[model samples]
Structure formats: C-alpha cells, structure tokens
Target: MTVRSLYLAPVTAVFPAPARTGQGGAAVYEQQRNRTSDADDSAARADRVVELLGARDEVELALKASLGGLPRERDETLARMAEVLQATAQGLALDAAAVWADMPERVLRNWLAKDPAFAAALRSAEALAGAHGLAAGPATTPTPAMVRVAVLALSRGATWPQAVAVAGFPVRGFRRLSQTHPVLAALVEAARRARPRKPKNFVPAGYRPRRPGQAPPGPRAFRLVRREDQVLP
Candidate 1:
C-alpha cells in the first residue's frame, strides 16, 4: 500500500468517520470526540483519588490490628482505665477517651499519679501500643505534634514526602492519625484545595529567557513587523 493509504487505513478503521453530509456533520463529530476524551481524563483522575483513599483505609486497619489488646484490670475503676487506654491506643485523645469510658478526666489523672498498679498498667499499655506503632508517653493521640507539623508544611505547598520529612513522622502514622482526627483531615483537604502559586519568572512558549538585569519583552501588537519594509517604530 501507498504511504498515505497506510497512514489513513488504521486511523479510519479505528475512528470510522461518519459520512459527511455537510460542515455541520464534521463539527458535530469533532465535538463528540472532544467530549469523550474529556470524560476519560476525568474518570482516570477520579480513579486515582479513590485508590489513594483505599490505601489509607488499609493502613488504618493494619495499625488497629497490630495494637493487640489492652491489659486486664479487676476493679471497676481500673477496668474503666483499661477502656480509656484502649481508646487512646486507637488514636483518641486522653480526656476524650476517659469521657468515652464514662470516667472523669480529673479522676483518671489522679489514679495515674496516686495508684502504683494503675501507673504500672499505664506503662504496660504504653509499651503495647508503642510496639504496634501507636504513640507512647503522656500524650494520648498518635503523634499530634507531628500531625500539626505536617499540616503546616502541607499548607505551605509541600508535597506528602516533604511534609512527612518536615514533621519527622512516618507516612503510615500520619495516615492513621488523620483517620481519628476529623479536624486534621479537614485541614489537609483545605490545603489540597489551595491553588499552587507559579514561579515569578514564568514565561510562555515561543519566548526566549531574558538575561539577568534585563526587562521582559512586551506584547506583540503588529503582525506586519515580520514582512519586508515593515519597520517597527
């Protein structure tokens, strides 16, 4: 086959252009092609977003499973403390978890300070949670300070890796934290919605880069400037 025939054969077989009744028919075909292309691009973007969300959910479930069980206690108050410890291990705040367990926040604090067995239980809970990638120590939630740092970095246009580095937190930990704290998730969404700023010296295509200390070229007003004897004033 000829070069022109070879080129047109595959394209015609794939697209199968409609019979040309007039210019309007061709215009309609073009519009349909453009619409189909746009729809496909939108679908691809949506799929990527869904995949990211699914990955985050998987990470959270894995972390929860790794946390194991809370220490058993005999007394009612100690049982309540165990409940609080479980809640906190799942990334809830200390006071919120205490309230969730139907215990007063002040009373929980008093128990931790005055009771030796309770303190020892607290230590055991911390070790268990920490072994499973949860935050340990006095703070209850999973790396609230690191989450704050990451949020701030993300707000300033940093990407996930950069934000995680700045926060000095693991990616899985950050994702897990976001699952518990709706406010942190909302802040991250807002940061994503914020438009990225372009560089100050951006230039369009067909333009040469300007030298340092030189001003930018102005807009073209005259089309005939390229023609012979058409001198720019």
Candidate 2:
C-alpha cells in the first residue's frame, strides 16, 4: 500500500459557533450572574442565622449556670422561664410564649418578680436580642396610637397588666414597647411612682382628730366579759 497522510481539521473550524455579543446573550449572562449572586446571599444569610442561634444557645447555657444550687423543682421552673424569655427575645411574643408553655401570662410575670435569676436571664436575653437586631427598637417618631397607649400607661396607678388591659392593648406588646422605647420606659417608671400619697394632716378613719396642742389619747385597759353559758371554774 502507498503511504498516505490524513489531515484533520481543527475542531472550531469544523464546528462553527454563534457569537455571543448581542442583547440576547447579555440577558442570559446577566440572569446566570444574578442566580449566582442570589445563591451566595442565601448562604451568607443562613450562616448568620446559625451564628445567632449559637449565640442564643450560649445565653441559655449561662442562664443554666446561674440557676445552679437551687432546688430541683425551682431550677426546672427557672429554666422553663428562661426558655420563654429567650423565645420572646427571638421575636416570639410574651403572650405567645405563655400560650405555648401552657400557662397564664400572670404566672410568667409572677415568676419574674419572685425569681431574681429568671429576671436576670430575661434582661440578658433582651440585651442579646437588641444587639442582634432581633427585637424592635424605638421608633424615630412615635405614632399617635403609641403615644396614646403610653399616656394611658403613665396616667394609671394600676399595675402594668391592669393598665394595659384597661387600655385594650396586649400587655406583652406594651411591655416590650416600653422596654425598648426610652420615653415609654420613663413614663412607665413615673406611673410606678404615682401611687397615692397621704396628706400631711391625714388621720386614720374612725379616729377623732385631736385638737391643736392636745395630748393624744392613751391606750385603754382591756376588760373581759363573763359568759353566761360557761360553768364556774
């Protein structure tokens, strides 16, 4: 057989390709780029969420450590309350946490009052929430409704729950709002100090007022009356 040489054409010469320089090509490129950017953004957000959750977990651990040396039942109760507080800090409403925990909101409030550890945990959780931007912050300019509610809270001598109930507002929302808002918190504090005070010259009911410079009445002697039904002892 005679020697023969075979030549092969370049792949690009054999298969001509369309140019990708028109609006259609640009549109496809832009779409793909947007998709990649969106995916990256989603991943970053997921990582941030995980970091926040881990921080919350650390708060819980610290809370548990603080609750040490308590009675078993009390420790459990405080732990539960801490969990509720953390949930609230993470955007769950206080009333909703109460509902989820199958208890009345008053119980939670009372726990906060009676247990200092629980209260501390609540403060920590709230601070964490604020730091992490999880909790709502004070408004730049409060709305009319917010002002009205705040005024109502300030004007009442009743407890927060009672005042909020009378105002037809949810106690949890009002409490959270007041805590986050400086003006509202100040108003609430003023309301707390607004308890009725007695006048300087006030006298007890059923007691006669003494004349000026008159001596106060002395203590009376006690006398026992004999019972007719009792036999002589």
Candidate 3:
C-alpha cells in the first residue's frame, strides 16, 4: 500500500479539534469541574491542619504564665482591681492604691495587659463608681482636692496625661472622675476653649469703626475724557 493509504488504513484516528455538544464533551466539562472542586477542598483542609498545629495559643499561655501568679479564674483578682478602680472613679486618689493588694504597680499593669476580662471589669467598675459617686476610702465620700488639681492643671494648657499626673490619677481613672465631676470637667473645657482675645485695635489706627473721627470717603467725580482729549501714542 502507498504511504497515504497506509496512514489512512487506521480506523481509530485522533481528531485535530475537541469534541463539542456530545457525551464526550459533557464528560470532559464535568471532569474539569470535579478537579477544581477537589483542589479547593484540599487547600482548605491544609489550612485547617496548619491552624490546628500552630503554637500561637501556646505562646500566649506561656507569656501569661511568666507574669507570675495571676489568679487562675480571674474573677477574684478582677473583683479586687475593680474595688480599687471604683474608688478612683469616685475621687479617691489613685495614688492611695499604690500598694494595691501588696502587689506592685508593674504587676497590676501586667495583669491588665494579659487578661481582657480583668480590664473590662476595671472599666465597668469605673463607670459604676462615677455614676454612683463611690469614694475610695471606707467613708465613700467624694473629695474635691484631687479633682481641683486636675482641673487646674488642664486649665493651664496641660495635656491630659500631665493633668492626670498632677491629679495623681490613672488615665482611665481620671476620665471616670470627669464623668462624676461634670462641673470641674466643664471648667477645664472652658479654660481650654479660652483663646487669646482679639485686640480692641484689630483694625489699623484711623480705620473706620476703630477711628470714629476719620471722615467718610468722598464720592468721586466721573468725568468722561473725549477721544480728542485722550493722550495716547
């Protein structure tokens, strides 16, 4: 047989183009879809496995452990911190709690940073104390000394942190105090709003309104110059 006849002798020859709109075409499309879905599922499963094996939780737990002996449940410690913070909000001097529970300020700060619930309790206590005017000492009476100092500092153009320091209150504690002592806060705000007064002599000397003796401007005469009288090159 000739080369052309030999090449054509095979009955099962491959086609140059792909099949379309038939069972073979449908099968190819379904296979492609199945492969895409399988790839997505595998990627998701891999991510889940990585997350399960991650050490992020372990690292946080280790850090918390290094902060010394915080209460295991957090409730008791939170209660104690709340008591102190509540007093602060009621105008009890924040410095009065310097030796809170015989724990140093650094230790208390560490606890505040590590535990979210403890921080939240502190906020709640401050709010409650502000609303109720609960004092820090056993007397539970609000004091004017500390708030007055803070107001004075703020009125003198001190930053909030500086004012807080002058008043010997924690930053959040001072905010709570402001809530309880709205009058002091308002005074501080007013003082801050007090800008340098515009001088009585804003306008130059001899200007109208500022210089009442200055004569009103005279009306100008509108005499039109004739084209012949105009002096132009």
Candidate 4:
C-alpha cells in the first residue's frame, strides 16, 4: 500500500493578488469599470420602475376621482376618513387621507367641511398628535390605551374627531359609544362653546355700533354660557 499526500496552492498564491502595475492593474481596473457600469445600469432601471409605478398610481387616482369610483357610502367615507385622520400622526393626515381614501387632500378637505363628524375627528387627531409628540403617524392597530387617551381628550374640550385621532376608531363608532355614554357627547358639545367666538361681520352683540379700529372687544365681550332664562334639557 502506498500513501500519497495531495497539495493545492492557496487561492491568494494561485491568483496572486493584483499588483498596482501593468497587466494585473489593467485587469483589476477593467473589472472595476465593468462593475461600475453594471451598477449604473441597475440603478437606472430601478429609477425607471419607480417612476412608472408612481405615474400609474397617479393615473389610477385621477380616473377614480373623475369617475366617482369611491366604493363606500358617503357616510362610510366620512367615517373612514375620520378614523384615518384620528389614528394617523401629525403632518401626515394629508398623505394618510390620500392613501386611505384614494382621494386628494383638497377633495377630502371639502368633505371635511361639509361633514361635522369628519371635521371633529380630524381636529381631535391633530390635537392628540401634537400633544403626545406623535406627529409621525398612526399605529396599525389602535390600542385600548389610545382609545382611553382619546376619550380623555374629548372630555377635556377635545372634539370627538380630535380625541379619537389616535384611537383608530371610526367617527360613527365613537358616536355609538357616545350614545351609550351620553356624558361623552355632552362633554364634547359643551366644550365646543367653552370659549366664546367673536360675532361674525364684526357686528357687536345687541347690534351696538362699533368704532373704527375696534376688534369687536375680542371673544371676552360675549359670555359662552347659556342664559338662566333659557330652557334646559
């Protein structure tokens, strides 16, 4: 029986690390240049794909808007918008609204104006997001803690929408909750008038004449409380 030992050159020795001169250097340079070209090509392709996808999304949104392709009922739309606005973080409601509803901020704003519940939800969300430094955005699933915070905010002069911003609950859902807990609705309603608003058109209360440069005595001129003679529920 014969014993044999096989020896193999190490990769470093066989390939002999490229020197910074002549053929070795030229080969290394060519390899690097090819890699750079390939990378540039890949990057360009990726950018083109991204651009195309973005354009497709824009086109789809435009078509949907023009065709009134919203899938939910009007009330449902409002509720969903409220939920997204409430749950989303600050500085992101506009983007969130678009993503959630496939509608532009301008269109959503128009709806918000016409829908008190939606407006309230948005305002509440903004309030909560600002207060908690949660301006980045909403969680995927709203926690019970978030709901509790929203409820507390509502009780503390925050509107339903504003309070529920972090709750991820819909406006209608909050309304239903309010029904079971009347205090919630009452508190929100009361908070609405907690601060007096200036008279419209700069007209003073009791139709009194105002002098030029007068700021209509500010909001303090009028009391927010109802009169004693007014009937109570």
Clashes of each: 0, 0, 0, 10
* C-alpha TM-scores of all predictions: 0.28, 0.28, 0.24, 0.30
Query: Which should have the higher lDDT, number 1 or number 2?
Result: 1
Model 1 accuracy (lDDT, Cα): 0.53
Q: Which stretches of candidate 3 lie over 4 Å from their true place?
A: 1-86, 92-95, 133-233
lDDT against true structure, model 3: 0.49
Superposed by TM-score, candidate 2 places the C-alpha of residue 47 at a distance from the truth, in angstroms, of 29
Residue 226, candidate 4: C-alpha displacement in angstroms: 45
Encode model 2's per-residue lDDT on 98-207: one tens digit a residue.
Answer: 53333457878887787777778777777776686555333333343333333433333346676554334567777777778655564455444443343487667887
Tens digits of per-residue lDDT for model 3 on 1-233?
Answer: 00011122221232222456688877776676665555444444433332332333354446656766542444334444764565456544444332223234565667778777767766776566667766344332335545544544454346788766645567777677667764545544543443223347366666646376778553332312223432211
- Stretches off by above 4 angstroms in model 4 are 1-31, 34-38, 41-90, 93-102, 131-233
Scored by lDDT, model 2 comes in at 0.51
Measured with C-alpha atoms, the lDDT of residue 38 in candidate 4 is 55
- Candidate whose TM-score is highest: 4
